[model samples]
Target chain A: MNPFSYARASDVADAIRQIAADPAARFVAGGTNLIDLMKYDVEHPARLIDISQLPLKSIEETPEGGLLIGAMVPNSDLAYHPLIEQRYPLLASAILAGASQQLRNMASTGGNLLQRTRCFYFYDVVTPCNKRKPGSGCSAISGVNRINAILGTSDACIATHPSDMCVALAALDARVHVAGPGGARTVAFPDFHRLPGATPERDTNLESDEIITGIEIPAKGFNANYSYLKIRDRLSYAFALVSVAAALELEGDTIKEARLALGGVAHKPWRDPAAEAAMRGQHAGESAFTKAADLLLQGAQGYGHNNFKIGLARRAIVRTLSQAARGMPQSQSVKKIR
Target chain B: MAQPGTAEPLRQTDVLPEKIQITLTVNGTRTGLAVAPWTTLLDALRDRLDLTGTKKGCDHGQCGACTVLVDGRRINSCLTLAVMKDGAEVTTVEGLASNGTLHPLQQAFIDHDAFQCGYCTSGQICSAAGLIAEGKARTADEIRELMSGNICRCGAYPNIVAAIQQAMERS
Candidate 1:
């Protein structure tokens, strides 16, 4: 890692002011992702603003019938919080399914959301990747395209967002609160991450000097019947090959409302509004889920190694919806769709 | 405080420089030192403090070869800076044995033949100790998940799991 100046901020204001003063400054919270990038020489910040001592480590109930999670809250705490487990079981499960105990203990909520892609090409300095080095050719396209993105991808980049928690957050319609030089602002979870359009170098909509203060998620009535399914090559400590986060609200065997998001398939958590729209008013069955998944993956383009992900993602959606629907009350059970 | 030729001008250099005083209590002893701004806790413990029991496998937080405890909470020491942990109590593998007696987990590992080359043994032991403290070894699935970060290229996972389970039962 390159030499860098470090300063432990006294408070949130001090952290923000210090970062705003230096363009090359970065806030180090958990250091789970940032330190990895630094070791690989991918992220070379001149100044590291340590904000681990900030008083933003709580999980409180907001006035608007939602949960406000502080940015500094560790992933382990969030995964095991009683409120999160009771109200947002999908989020808890998603957090548990990611990384490992040691990593989850060290990774904060804000750090998890801001984590970069785990693209092999991006991490390997010998390879050329536009996301790692601007204007550099993408080596994953012609080399190993197995773990690359199949949706929301561009010719310049095909890296998938490697986060399971963000997939659940996208499905739950959470909101991110950030503080920067311009002041505090809220960005919806879906819009917080940007696709690699012409510039794959930029990951999120966060400004260079922005600090994520907290994440807010409005209470969902259907959270009681939610599920997060992540399929990976190994049973533990591995990124997902195809994952789905789904919540269902059923009205006497028919779908009243549904929210679905796919991970390991797109540049960001792929929220399929069309799939959600198709599930409404329809019976909660495998056929309905299959059709909706097909619609969601209509324009999916995959390479030779990852073509199986489309089918895996479709099946994952069906299985998740089925499981979530089964967990609902008896009155919600209707005719099972084949 | 009015001196002209003071202290050789502090030797100016291009490297971004900042020194922070860190006082760590390790294995029942208090030690103080000035570490560079970017020095990780693992480096401080291993290189500066001469605690070579903690290994550095994948320096990028992927491997658990540098797992340590700060105030009873387990963390990837390689991902944390030593200066950021001033006055914190750290427990490494070197501190596991007490009064010349091996810890239960360490004894179980040796009895079960949990490791082959023993490169990742110290980390596995430290991480397993923390895992037991956190109640992560309740079930086989939970044990596998909790110990996932510590890789054993010798494919000693089955024995490692057995050793951990035996130690947990004894504790």
Candidate 2:
């Protein structure tokens, strides 16, 4: 890590102003991902504006009966928050299934959304990576890419976003609240993260000067059944090879509404409304689920090593949807797809 | 007088050009130190403060060998900057034992033979200590899931789980 001047932001305005003034400065929240990148020489900031001390640490109830989660709220706190566990258990389960206790204690909600891909080539400075350095040829395109992206990938980059919480939030219709030099704006979860198109260096649609202040999870009617299932190499402390967040609203045995999002397969949290629509008014069973799974993985073109993820993701969707339909507890959601 | 939770203003001369002076309440002792912005909390504890109980297995936060308590929460100290945690109370493995007595987790580790090489012991114990405080680990499976951050390459997981369960029952 290079030497940098550190300043703690007293408020949101101060954080934005400080970062806007220096293009070389970056906000340091949680430091779980940023510090790791700095150590790997993938990121080198001249100044660090510490936003951890800011007042954005509350997880509160909005006037509309929805939840407003502060950006600086630790992952563990958000995961175990009474309102989150009760109302948005899928988000809670995804978080707990992503990282271990120690990491969850340090990682923040906003930072988790901005976490970089875990692609080996992106971190290895010696190797050429377009995501790490624009115009630098992507090594993962020709190198080991078992964990690479299979959806929303471009010729420039094939890195997948490694966030399980965001996958659930995508299914729950969450919005990101950001403040920047222009003004404050709300970005829908789908638009917040950008696919690795021409400019793979930028992971999010967030401007360089903007600071993520909070996340707003709108009060949704689909609260009957939900499941977040993560399939990884290990039972714990490993990134998801393929994960599914399935939430269903059913009338008796027929699905009235549904939301499906996938992780470990796309540049962003992969959500297809068509797949969700296929389940409407249909019986919540294998046939309907298999149809939705097929629609969800329709254009999922996989890299060589990660071709197995295509099949793994399809089965995971089926299993997670089954669990959600039965209203099984989220504890049974964490499984290793073989 | 400043507000209770408000942070103190940055003093230019406190850093001596590149190093900044920050107060950290480590092991219940309030101490002031100066360090560069790049210095990790693990380095501050081991190199500057001479508290070497926390081992650095992988400084990238992948391995939990550098686990320490900040505000009673276990975090990989290697991943956090020392300057970022001014005014926070940090507890390392050295702080676990009090007044010449071993912490219950430490005692249980010995009783259950929870370690082989023991490089990751302090971190494992510290992480287990934090887990115990959270009061979420009810069964051996839950304990294993929660404590998955701390890696025991020596393969003493069975004993480690046994020790944590024994400690949880006693408490």
Candidate 3:
């Protein structure tokens, strides 16, 4: 890794001021992803503002009966938090289904949201990647792209967002609280991450001077019946090929409401209102689930090697919804990989 | 591609930054050290502090050979910067045995022959030690799933699982 000046921020204001001073400066909370990218020469920040010491490691209950997760809270702690496990079990399961025990211990909730895609070409400095180098072109477009995106992909890039927690957050209608040079603001979960449009270099809509403070999960009725299913090449320690986060509110036999999001299939968590709308007032069964899945994958187009992801994602959506509808425990059904 | 640990050409600058001082309790010893901003915790332990029990396999955090406990939680030391962990407690494999007496997990690994080449033994033992402390894994499947970060190419997983189970039962 290249040498850089490191400074520990005293608070959020100090962090924002420090980062705003240098364009090449970045905030390092967990260093799980940033340090790895530095080793691979994918990132070379001139200055690192260490925000790990800041007091953002709380898991508090909002007055509206929702959970407010601090950005610096470790993934392991957040996953096993009594409030999260009891109320937002989908988020807990999604967190557990992403990384191994060791990585989860080191990863922070905010850092997990900012994790880059595991696209092989993106990591290999020799290859051409639009995300890595603005106009270099995407090698994955014509190379091995079994893990690339199948939805919300652009001609410039085909990378998928490699986050299970973000998928669950999108399903639960979570909002992101950000502190920046301007001031503090909240961004909807779906809008926080950006699609790979012409500017594939920008992974998120967050400004360069902004730092994520916390993630606010609104009290949802789907916590009782939600499932996070991740399918991967291995049973553990690998990235997801296709993962589904499904939550349903059932009124007896008919679906009163539905919340759905997909990971490893799009630049961001793929959530379509039409697909979620198809689940409302529909009977909970294989037919209705399949119909919703088809609606979810309607406009999904895939690259050469990753074309199979569309089918895999459709099946995953159906299976995840079925599990959620039955309130079946999401244990060992999906694998955790980081 | 330059693999990690290779010395890279330093960029020419007018002024060089000063090393950052950090205090850490290794095993049971509280030590203070100054490290460069680029130095990883794994490098500080192995090169600076002369603790080589922690192997550096895949320094990019892909392999768990560099696993260690920071504040009693298992993490990839290779992925953590030394300067970031200013006043934390770190436990390496060398810290497992105290007063010439091996930890129960270490003894269990030896008794069950949980290692062949032994390249990944230290990491496996440390990770299992953390797992036991967490008190989450109850069954063999849970053990295997939780220990997936530490990869043993020699295929010593069954014996490792058995050893961990024995240690769990004893504890």
Best by TM-score: 3
Supply candidate 1's per-residue lDDT for B170: 93
Candidate 3 residue A89 C-alpha distance from true site, Å: 1.0
- Residue B96, candidate 2: Cα error in Å is 0.8
What does the lDDT read for residue B135 in candidate 2?
93
Residue-wise lDDT of candidate 1 within B1-171, one digit each (tens)?
112112112222486586888799997799999998879999999999999999899887777888888888778899888878889899999898999999999999999999999988988998899889987458765787778889898889999999999999999
lDDT by residue (A1-338, candidate 2, tens digit) is 76678898999999988998899888999999999988877787878999998898999889988889999999999988888888888888889988878889999899999999999988877677778767777888778999988898999999999999999999999999999888999999999999999999999999999999999998872555988888888888899899999999989999999999999998899998999999999999999999999999998887799999999999889999998999984572224332
The interface root-mean-square deviations, each candidate in sequence, come to 12.3, 11.7, 5.1
DockQ of each: 0.31, 0.32, 0.47
Q: Best DockQ goes to which candidate?
A: 3
What DockQ does candidate 3 have relative to the true complex? 0.47
Better structure of 2 and 3 per lDDT: 2
By descending lDDT, how would the candidates be arranged? 2, 3, 1
C-alpha-based local distance difference test score of model 2: 0.90
Candidate 1 chain B: minimum summed lDDT over ten consecutive residues — where? B1-10
Q: Is the docking of candidate 3 incorrect, acceptable, medium or high quality?
A: acceptable
CAPRI-style class, candidate 2 = acceptable
Model 3: what TM-score? 0.96
lDDT of 2 at B80: 94
Ranked by TM-score from best down, the candidates are 3, 2, 1
* Candidate 2 all-Cα RMSD: 6.3
